[model samples]
Target: MSKPPSPILDLSHTGLLIAAHGSPSTKGGRTSSRKHAETIRNLGLFADVRAGFLTEKPFIKDVLDGIHLPEVYVVPNLAYRGFVSTTKLPQALNLTGEVTERITPNGHQRVHLCDPVGTDPSTAKTFAVRILSTMDSLKVPDTDTAIVVIGHGSGRGRESFEHTNRIARDLSRFGIIPPVFTTFLEEPPFIKNWRDLTRAKNVIFAPYLISDGFHGSEEVPRDIGFNTKSEIFIERLSHVQPNEMNQDGQRLIYLPPLGDAPEMAELIINRVRASLT
Candidate 1:
């Protein structure tokens, strides 16, 4: 009798680590990280899916140190390539090489650094959909409401702000006729200028961020002259009581962060597969 054929090993079943800037508050504070992992697992894209974070406790290094995988790909859950994507991430992983660095610390496990989720063009399209959907749900007039996408803008690198601007521009094609502008956390046309950027009396504040952490929860509202009660303000404005708007102003609605949309997951998986080839 002929010998039985040996089983084939599928190297594509390598492990995937979805890393993000984690949060300290709430359960599974790494919301985006977990969502990306789940999306990958749900799509049957990878054999193993794990999560890591930069901020908060249990940094990426700590998480990677405990996990065991044949080949690990550190995919940032962030939208753009800023400090986290450049210096902090590489140093945390002990990586020393070029942009697409592949480092094997102690020659044990191989780790590959993949492009951030924001760099992918597909992300722009996904963001467009999220903004429109939020507008629809809030019953805001697409033609009258000004959609503002808030990003963690950087002065050193224009990539993050550029990506955000592209996303806002892309959203215009969706028939939201008023205007789509972008604001930043570190750059000009800051949050304070939000009221002046658009002519729409009703504003929809949508964060172009991945998590509902400090920037989304605290800083954003404080910058706008309100407190952590931003959601309350948004809800109250949705109905637009006659007395709410000041003598020279109109109501403003703040939407939640665009965290781990299904389309975002698709974009990430596609980017990773493309990078591998």
Candidate 2:
């Protein structure tokens, strides 16, 4: 009875699940989840790390059923949209308005669900790092570039859009760069208005989504006049080739969705650890 030093945790008996509301049309979201799950599994953190989805094959219930451990942890792999974080995940996992759902088989299976992992304030720092790195790669000074944190703002979940703004504000206050903007695909001050509203000559666009699916990669880029092919967006983390683009008078830099970044995998691990306390 000694704990493995690899994961550095005594949760060898536990199974970890990274849960996402996967895309039905595009495999990007689910594929990213599986990639991250594999990354976590390589870390030897739990008995197993599995990706579960609400819309794709290998559904949440399927993974839940397959995990034959007494303690199972499910981390919501979402951007903290009110719908998915509050309603969809709970309903799909059959929590019945509880923090966890218990099932008794041989002894018992205690399934603990964690909150939205991507939209946590901790990710603000990660976003800042990504922006800085992108700026460095483009040879653009951080102070000279404005950052816009983009989201698929939902009117049904106004809180989700507000959270996007909060991340932008945090990035601004944290001094990643001044002139931070928050815009969306489905709401006001949208992507089309990026040039009109933003004060900087160069802008770094960062996605505040779980995956670079249809919206983040293709739809958003197309709206911004990049006009990339839809098929390429499905598997790409960074949609626009060559990173930076010159749009007449202004410069545009696209950063991959946070969910696709390695930092996000670390954040997911942190989320699972947080649930332990």
Candidate 3:
């Protein structure tokens, strides 16, 4: 005869933990984490939502230890798959379940590693829309303005830059002819030749980045010049702290982080639900 559904299934509790490459200099990292947590909380889907880090202060161990939830799902807030996403995060969290074959430390927490946000198509669309909107705000004509998608280009893994380039290429189909070029802190073009790369006098500098930390605050401006003569749009995915902006005029507009966008929250939820099956 058919028996009643297992009682153990009813006792199961699900949790979500977002892991990011944490920042020590600026509070952007924490802000992103908080926003993700809040989104999950607002949805009321999971029993708990927590945040962890791969580097710099409040390590993964701390986050795992702090969580009271029994079963947890860890979503890496990283854009690309690299040391942090592939090795560092998994090693630190010691996650095990349907994904992990063997046992490791912190195995008590049923942790599932969700793919990085950047890999999601929704994220790419969101970034593209934001960049385009930022350019529109600058009164930079689509024909004249050249959109430069500045990413933290790296020699280690081409994934980071490639993802940005892919987004740019996809958005190009929408008639945004703004030339999308990529420069790196470690690679060539070096943010110095940004103007030369795209011969458009009206250039929209959008950092295809998530946070406004070292790269966003100092390096980007230092090399590219803080001259607001040309429109500058910093496309970040985290909230902008008051100190980050010194509003002189509308010449330079630091658009809100992609995380603040409700679209992002929807993307995260969709990603989670898709992975469940």
Candidate 4:
């Protein structure tokens, strides 16, 4: 089938810059961001598409300097609209607000700062799609499965925890799957208590994280009794790992972070488009 035309028009000179929170210890986060940027680039909707990181090479400032486009939309690839999206990103890009007009060495450029892609309610739809798809592949009925979304909630503020809980609430409302739960690494009802929190025989762990890195590959698994601290960290080969493990009389299926979802490229585009109007 032919691909649908893009919603926005006349973007021959427009550009997209995905500002991501890079992982210094692992390349997974940077790789995920670049893949999303490439996916959007393939759509032929913009003159340029690039991913820049905060903790890695080709940093945000460098990427911004390299872009010569007259208009660029900066979208935070983070899973939450907390400190990084609201303060760190804008400060790094020298943006004062949603729209910032600045004169760069390359030329005069107009920067449009957009909300983090995770802030989009449709992101919950993406989560639902991923969860249901994984369940179908595993032959695990939704009725018997429990979705536990794990996030790194902060003690400093409620934004991180609230964002994760919101996704859980949204998934619950979808009614496609029963018994969705939320847990955090830094806050109450922590991930270590996942098994005790649900009664389902099959538990699917959806990391509400932008980048899987050490959290998804190691910490979460260890916390949930799937792996030991000494176990080798497995890099994600796909969105859903084919090997499901049996843990304490229950089936455990862990998925890659939300940013790695195939729908993310389109989601980023939508967020950028929304900023235009």
Candidate 5:
């Protein structure tokens, strides 16, 4: 017996709009979102693919207004299903629910709103691969190493904190790496207090964010004990071999955000495909 052919995905009649929380001061946020759109555009699945931001030019509202496709899918390119993804983005797009239909110049239009990429069940697995690869490159062993997954926790709701902790827990259960810890910029057990959370000799800081925006590029580095005088400073650190610091034999390694990860494009596509079902 032979394996059956894989199912074909066709969305030639639909348009995709990636809604993101952009930063005017940092280019990484908008740049990553547009990069994802470009990656998906080359695949030619959707009739059109474009990225829109909340705090940048070509805003979400304008992008939605320009799209005239019979069907549209709005996927929030956010890290967590927090206020930005579930509330701000939806309100900007005027979405009533998961599926919103309205009369427009293009006749009857249907729009599907997808959950944030980070909320996908497979996200934890993708994240694990990145962490394992990073560790392999550093020649670091799982013993005596603590992994801290940091997120931009929200005060408005517990969604951000909950999702971050869940991902951290899931990563820990994999047993491939050392103990995984959850920290945040806007919540308790903050990134600045990593020493208080765990006692691992070697520490790895992984940012659980979509992009190296204000939080990732600026706050993360500062919290992890680096001088973030400019956004480009963090980029330079990423290129440094062993991007770690030694203090009395203890080591601290900082990993970049997941925005540039190749797996992210797949995660976005999975979110869109799930909406179709």
Candidate 6:
């Protein structure tokens, strides 16, 4: 089979805006976004790199208005093209759909909206890397580890689950981790019943979602009995000092969500660049 074309593009003179669905209580949101912005800025690929969010400061319109560049590319820091990416984000940015022309003080700025980070094909590698890196960080062996990819599935929509399935399929084919299984919070194949899904003595449960917010940080842990409550986002992984925790005779590691991780910057950049083509 032929390889796919490179997603990187000549993004010179174009500003990059990473669009994220920020949380009011997520202290890491700004920090993570700033780190990604700095990382992309350090690359010197574009005129500038900034984060514009739907629920936080330096919001989409504000960030868009602040930029003096002639063009800007907005990449959704999302896991899928659900209502957020497809409707809310674009609507917030004043986009008719994909490309929206914004009237800045200097002149009309051309804004190109890229698909969410989760929609990219490269995320599968990111997922694999996240799982492996978590294992390495915790000094856990790769022996009989059931790598569980968790998505913030919707009970009402198929789009989120569909993209998740594709990504999971791609990740499985990569063979980075044997027996890569996928589950969701809202949908079937629930995270609570992961043990029944696979017989691997060890497990690494990873959230396929973008943020370290409520879903990944609180809800997931609560659902999986890793936490007592889902009311607050824990500073790090829930109620564990040793990287790997023993849950019902199974060694499990709960990996952080993709949004807060630094590795996500590469995937964001790729999605932004891919939008140019």
What are the C-alpha RMSDs, in order, of all predicted structures? 7.4, 3.7, 7.3, 2.4, 3.7, 4.6
lDDT by residue for model 2 over 41-159, one digit each (tens)?
88676888899888887899888888888888888888874788778878887876535657656567888877678755578888777777777667887666687778878868688
Error of 1 at 137 (Å): 2.5
* lDDT of all predictions: 0.67, 0.74, 0.60, 0.80, 0.80, 0.74
- Per-residue CA lDDT of model 4 for 1-277, tens digit only, reads 0243556667768999999888777664336788888887887888999989887876998898899999999999988889888988888888989999999887899999998999886888888888888777778886787888998898878999988988888886555556888998889889999877896888888889877456766687778876534323253334335235786788887777777776777778888878877
lDDT of 1 at 189: 76
Superposition TM-score, candidate 1 onto the true structure: 0.79
Worst 10 residues of 2 by lDDT: 233-242
> Considering TM-score, which of the candidate structures 3 and 6 is the better prediction for this target?
6
lDDT accuracy of residue 104 in candidate 1: 45
Residues 1-277, model 6: lDDT tens digits: 0222343566768899988887776674344566677787887778878887788787887887788998888888888888888889888888886788767779988888888887777787777766666677776676777778888788768988898888777875555656778899888888888877987778877778787567776677666667624223343443222134677788877777766566678778778767766
Q: Which ten residues in a row have the lowest lDDT in candidate 5?
A: 1-10
The regions of model 1 sitting more than 4 angstroms off are 1-12, 25-30, 42-44, 97-108, 225-227, 230-249
* Per-candidate clash tally: 1, 0, 1, 0, 0, 1
The TM-score values for the models, in the order shown, are 0.79, 0.88, 0.77, 0.91, 0.90, 0.85
Better of 1 and 3 by TM-score: 1
- Candidate 5 — what's its lDDT? 0.80
lDDT of 4: 0.80
Clashes of 6: 1
The most accurate candidate by TM-score is 4
Provide the lowest-lDDT 10-residue window in model 1: 238-247
Global local distance difference test of model 6:
0.74
Across residues 1-277, which tens digit of lDDT does each residue of candidate 1 receive? 0221122334355677777888776347336567667766765556677777777666788877665665667777787878888788888878664323243453466667888877776766666666667666656675566777888888788887887787778776755566778898899779877877876777777778876567766677567655555566544422321112222475666665666455666666655665666
C-alpha positional error of residue 176 in candidate 1 after TM-score superposition, expressed in Å = 3.5
Worst 10 residues of 6 by lDDT: 233-242
